[model samples]
Target chain A: MSCWETLADYALRSVGIGERLLPRSDFTICQQVVLIGSGMIWNVYFGVLALCSGFFLATAVALGKASHSVWLRKPSEWFIFIFRGSPLFIQFFFAYFLFLSLKQVAPIFTPFTSAWAGALVVLFLNTAAYSGEIFYGALLSIPKGDTEAADAYGFSGWARFRRIIWPTMLRLAWPAYTNEAIFLFHATTLVFFSGFPAQQQRGDALYYANYFADKTFNPFIPYPILAGYFILLTLLLIGLFGLVNRRLNRHLPRERRAKVRFRPNVIR
Target chain B: MFSYCADPDTLSGLTWLSCYLTTGKHMAFYVSFGTVLLLLAITAPTALLFGFGGAAAARARFFPLRWVGKAYISVVRGVPDIAFFLFFVIALDQGFEWLRHKVKCPDWDQPIRQGSDFVVCDAAKLPLGNAAQWVHETYGFFLAVLTFAIVFGAFAANVLFGAMRAVPHAQLETAEAYGMTQRQTFWRILVPQMWVYALPGLSNLWMVLIKATPLLFLLGVEDIVYWARELGGTKTPRFTDYPHGDWRMWYFLVLLIFYLAFTRVSEVVLDRVMKKLTHGQATAGGEAQRKAA
Candidate 1:
């Protein structure tokens, strides 16, 4: 078959769009590229959704960790510790097993046994914990004069936090948060590789790369293709996060601006 | 493993629980934790060495050597290490076999890559095809060690590169004034000073390495995750005397707790080490210590 037909059939195969069956044997470079690129759809899906939703919890978690009340601080501390201390791989296995047991208990949880819900949940919590720690560190490093200036302006409580504290915390955290975001996207590859089952042979880029590697017994081609896709994804992520970083530090002069360089810390 | 385990059916309550925990598979589960620790113990120094080489080579006078070094460091930057892990294992395995095949069977007629199969002469197989179970496992563990070292070495090289540059220019200038050559200055002055700057990144990398240990199961190693799944799956009465429901979750929870405690302890120890390192230094941490004293 032609490369165009192959692309048409497998371009959206990862999301179960065009192709129902994966290339079985005599795999072409076109099939590997199309299918692996298709698989990137799931990686982006997991990364974007988890990072988007994880942001809110991460903000709350950062605030909780910074709170004066022990009641609030303890849970936040333990939550961050539990998720951050343990490997996300183990967490995925433990969670899948836990979710499986819960599925036995209730029908509503059956979806959680699959990679989409279950691994996303794991990635969500994992990124939140890492980002929360970054934010908490940012919170502590916020200049004391900012809060004092806020009090002089009749800002207090939530108003003070929103006006003075939070933005500065974000600005300070943005570089490291960008790193977290990169790692989180990279961590999405772990989703299908983990205990969570990828239903109907639909999986992320790494999953397809793994499949093609197994079939062709040539890791050279498929793995590099997957890497190329990820490099593009990472570049896109950095460009996107760089925009946010710019907006966050918009007030700062050029010399003072923190550059969003690639600082690769993996698995949080 | 115990006398009571001999007749698990007759046992009950705490005795049954004790016997269940002492079963052969459960013993492997416990041993797997040691495997993780061993991997860390072996990989850490090996990776640090690899990273140091990469970083030094990146700073080399030769352009090709520098390019190779830079490539080594940046290869893991945008890519997932898991993908690298999966790719490298098979690639390296086949690579070694192909090299051996070339040397061992030069007269062989068939091409090595036939369709999807990687056909090497049996004589050229790694560890040999009929090698003992332990030899095969050791070969696998060795491959895993090399893979971990190669991947983490890149991260470490990045950190070490930054640290090497972070060393004060005045120090290197002083070393030159004292007639120290570049290599001598690098080994004696720069390496010593760079560690302080490198410690923070190295510590973070160490934690990441600790967390990455579970991926060993994916490499087909019988690490904790492997044993947890094997032992935790539901066992019927036909399979064993002490039958139980699905207990994989509980086993995983145990693995979870083990990691938490391990990281917590590492954090405490690392903090103390950082304090000791910074005690008389001129960094922010040292200033804080001085003020406190």
Candidate 2:
């Protein structure tokens, strides 16, 4: 089949659209590209959803870590320590089987057995922990004068945090948080590789890359294509986060504004 | 194993538990944890060597060499490292055998790529296709070690390169004024100062490297993750004496705790080492030390 037809057939194939069965034999470059690109939809889905939902939890975690009460502080500290200390690969494995047992226990958790809900939950917690640590560091490093100024303006408690504290904490944390985000997107590729079965082979970019590599016994093509897609995604993420970085540091002079440098954390 | 472990079917309760825990397979499971530690031990220094080479090359004055170094350093940054791990294992395997094919069997090649198969001659196969089982496992472990070094080396190179630049220009000027040659300046002045700056990042990378040891399972080595999955799966009476329900969740929980404990201990130890290293230095940590004194 033509590249256009292959694209049409398999473009949304990862989500179980268009193509019912993946091309099994005589794999074409077009088929590999289309199917792998289709697989990217899942990566974006998991990355975007997890990062969005994790952001709030991360903020809460950051605050909890900084809270004066041991009740709040101890759990937050342990939460960050437990998640951040373990390899995310192990977390996915542990969570998948945990969810599997949970499904056996109750019908309400049946959805957790599948990759979508189950893997998403794992990624959400993992990123929140990593990002939460970043934010807590930033929260501690927030300029004392800024809070004093807020107090002078009669900004107390929630108003003080919402108005004066959060923006500055975010500003301090944005560079590292951008790195966290890129890593989180990269981490999404592990979901299918983890215990969560790709129901109907609806897997992520690395999943399809792995499929072609297995089928063709050629690691060159599909893996590079996956890499190219990810590099593009990484650059796009940098650009997107750079915009936010600018907004965070807008009041600062040009030279003083922090640049969103891509210091990729190799593993988490 | 114990003498009683020979007949696990007859055993029950704590006796059965002790026997099962001491089984050969369980022995392998325990050894796999050592495999992780071994991988870390080998890979850490080798990757630092790779990173040092990369950073030095990146600092090279020649344009082409600098470009190559820069490329080496950035290659692992954007891609998912799992993809790199997956690719490099097969890629390096094929690469080695293909090189062996070219060297050993120069004249007898129809084609290496026969549709879907990557067929090098029998003699050209890694571990020679007839080598002992241990050789194959060692070769697989070697490839995994190489892949980890390559990926983590790039990250380290980035850290070291930044650390290299963070070494002030005045340090070099002072060395020049002291009549030191460029090589002498680099070795004596630049390199010594570079470590102080590199320590923080290198330590971070060390933590990451520890976590990444589990990916050895994906490389097909019988690491802890591999063993956990193997041992934790449901076993019928036909398979072995330890017939039980699926306990992969508990197995993984053990793996999780292993990592958490490992990281916690590393953090505590590394922090002390950092303090000792900074005891009299000009760095902020040292300044704080001086203030406390």
Candidate 3:
């Protein structure tokens, strides 16, 4: 078939939208590009959803970790430690099995046994823990003068936090959080590999890349395409986060605003 | 191990549990942990060497060498590392075999890529077709270590390159003023001083390396994750003595605890090392130590 037809067939293949069977032989560059690009849909889906939902939980977790009450503090500390300490690959396996066993106990958990719910839940919790730790560090480093100023303005408790504390904490944490978001997107590639079966052969970018590599006995093409897609995604993320970061530090003088620097460290 | 455990089918209660846990497969499962540790032991120094080479090359006077090193270091930044891990394993394997093919059977020119199959002469095969099982396993493990070293070397190179830059330029200037050659300044001063700055990043990389050990399973080595899935699956009484429900959760739970404890211990040790390394250095940690003293 023509490359255009192949593109039309396989463009949304990862989401089970277009093509049914992936190209097995006579693999064209077009097929590899289209299928892997299609697979990126899932990566974006998982990354965006998990990051959006995780942000709120991370804020709560950050506060809980920094809270005065022992009841709130200990669980938050342990939550962050467990998720951050363990490998996400192991977490994915552990969570998949845990969800499976839960399904045995309660039929309600059956849906979670699938990759859709289970892997997303794992990614969400994992990012929350890492981001929560970053946020907690930022919270701790918030200048004492900031809080004193809030007290002086008679902004107490929730008002103090909402108005004075949250923004500053976020401003401090934005760079690390950006790194966490990029890593989280990179990490979405691990779900299918972690034994969460991609229903109907629909999988992420790495999955399709891996498929093409296996089929063609050539690793040169598909993997680089996957990497290119990821590089574009990473740049887009940096740009988006840069905009938020500017807004976070808008009140600061231009000389004082922190420039976003990409320091790629493995947060997992 | 117990005499009563021999006939596992007849045993009940604790005896059955004991025997099951001490099965031959369980021994292999236990040994895989050692494989992980072995991988770490080998990969750590090798990756550091690769990183050092990369950093030095990046700083080389030659433009092409510097560009190559810079590319090696920055490549990891844009892509997911898992992509590298998956790609490099097969690519490196084929690369090795292809090299061997060219050298070992130069005249036997059946194309290496016949459709999807990578056909090499028997002599060119990595382990040789009839090599012992242990040799095959060892070769696979070696390839895994190499792949880990390459990917992580890039990360370490990034850390080390920055650490190299973070070393105050004045220190090198003073060395030069003291009549130290560029080589002497680099070896005696720059290399020694860079560690203090590099420690935090290196420690973080160490934690990352520790977490990455489980990816060994993806390289087709029967590591802990492999055992967990294998042993945790539900088994029928007809199949073996240990007939149980799916216990993968518990197996993974144990893996989780193992990793958590590993990281906790690593963090403590790394902190102490950092303290020791920072003593009397020209850094904030050193200044804090000086004040405390």
CA lDDT of every candidate? 0.90, 0.91, 0.92
Write the candidate numbers in order of decreasing DockQ.
2, 1, 3
Clashes of each: 0, 0, 0
Q: Is candidate 1 or candidate 2 better by lDDT?
A: 2
Clashing pairs in 3: none
lDDT of 1: 0.90
Task: Indicate whether candidate 1 or candidate 2 has the larger DockQ.
Answer: 2
Off by over 4 Å in 1: none
The ten-residue window of minimal lDDT in model 2 chain A covers: A259-268
Model 1 Cα displacement at A24 (Å)? 1.1
What DockQ class does candidate 2 belong to? high
Tens-place lDDT per residue, model 3, A1-268, is 9999998899988877786988878898988999999999999999999999999999999999999999999999999999999999999999999999988889999888888889999999999999999999999999999999899989998989999999999999999899899999999999899978888899989999999998888898899999899899999999999999999999999998888888766536
- List where candidate 3 sits over 4 angstroms from the true fold: none
lDDT digits (tens) for residues B1-293 of candidate 3: 77888677788888788898999899999999999999999999999999999999999999999999999988765568789888899999999999999999999968888877889999999988899999999999999999999988988888899999999999999999999998999999999999989999999999999999999999999999999999999999898777999998999999999999999999999999999999998788899999999
Compare the candidates by DockQ and give the number of the best one. 2
Candidate 2 lDDT, B219-239, residue by residue in tens: 999999999999999899997
